[model samples]
Target: MTDQPAIELNNGVRIPQLGFGTFQVDSDETQRIVETALEAGYRHIDTAAGYYNEDGVGAALKASGLARDDVFLTTKLRNGDQGHDSALAAFEASRKALDVDVVDLYLIHWPTPTRWLAPETWRAFEKLLADGAVRAIGVSNFLPHHLGRLLETAGVTPAVNQFEIHPTHQQPAVQDASRAAGIAVEAYAPIGKGEDLSEEAVEAIAQAHDVSPAQVVIRWHLQQGRIVIPKSATPERIRSNIDVFGFELTTGQLDALTGLERANRLFPNPDEFEASQFRD
Candidate 1:
């Protein structure tokens, strides 16, 4: 098998620059889609307990016959399980569901401030890392203040922050915070859920590169040094998404794409919104 390029996290863990996302992927279809991705050269798989497909992902991993070290697996701690003990138990449940002894990366799904205990949850993530149950620990949908609190309380920086970022919602502040703290930013919903890829600038860049709008967008994420998890159940789109490694985006092209930012967010901003009600 050919080697795929990897991005090194702040903590020295290596992750594939691009990964397949299983958000909203049905449990029944997870195995097949994940298998297709593995066959197509994706070694990294991103899922969450909320996605409810860890078992299927585990089955696909086994079916792929790839060694455990060869595939990078990531799962998240749901909002309901935010306290230290609750987070730890959630981690175990996730490991059981995925049938993996150790997950490559585990994340706090969201910083639901109303819970008023996100900092304590970070402590649990720290314990998970110290115990070697998770190779690295991070957070998802965290704003600058949430990250700051984690840093202040845990004294350990998150290796990565997975959040909603696309051309429409550039999130410059969060990006700056992550960069300053030496934490990598992983972009979820990198395509903006089919929202703004049709902008004239994005179209022009796609035409210049002779790639799909999705590919251009994913490449833009790569160029910005953000890990991109692009979800696709279709085999052709899956293949097209990772084909970005073969091309380069010029600085001018990247600038033009970045200039298209309109502060449009496709997902809810966890900082302003209350996720406590959504907790199960």
Candidate 2:
């Protein structure tokens, strides 16, 4: 119950402007951490099947005693499960793990061009959307070329394109392509892995606002109208991460952060990522 603004997706579903992420959260500790996030006013949560913590997220939601409609939940398909039937089955597994009848947003975890199975996997995603299993469907880690190829056979344009976006690694081309197609842009690792928070530009802005560098970076994403998800295992950091609505950044500060971009992409190339990340 916070004053977070909601962004409407291409399909009319609204999502929180900021969210808590469970990327590296261990399943053994996810429930406690997520419950902490919930208590800190994070109404949006992002998880993935590959993260192996949906059950914990579901446990946290149930433990919080919040109504189903009170939160927006998102999860992603595992890279290995990239086919019509496999993807559909994977969704069922994720749904059951999360204990949700309908997922707010379901994303194909990666483009996995090497697999040559994304188009087929997207068919399953369309089926899920049509069948009302998910409120919206999208993809993550996709670049412009990936989106272009998927668009060739996709009947439903993705509602969102989430990727690693930070002060240092802004993907302008992908952002342009996604927005051009009416898809919302979501940022992961918004504060960057390590070096971003310590940068002079970010630190100077933080000093001006009297906030943490992470908060300043998060604010930069929010002020730009982009959805941001920042993850933390610490309670103080988790609460502090969402307390970014108290102040704003000036145009000069925002431009300074934008000027920090050096194409420092931190993730693997989607095209070269093998479809089967893990084997049975």
The prediction achieving the highest lDDT against the true structure is 2
Which ranges in model 2 have alpha carbons more than 4 Å from their true place? none
Q: How far off is residue 234 in model 1, in Å? A: 0.8
lDDT of 1: 0.88
TM-score of model 2 relative to the true fold? Answer: 0.98
Which stretch of 10 consecutive residues in model 2 shows the poorest summed lDDT? 271-280
**How many clashes show up per model?**
0, 0
Q: Report RMSD (Å) for each prediction in the order shown.
A: 1.6, 1.1
Tens-digit lDDT track of model 2 for 82-137: 89999999999999999999999999999888666889999999999999999999
What stretches of model 1 exceed 4 Å from their correct place?
276-280
TM-score of each prediction: 0.96, 0.98
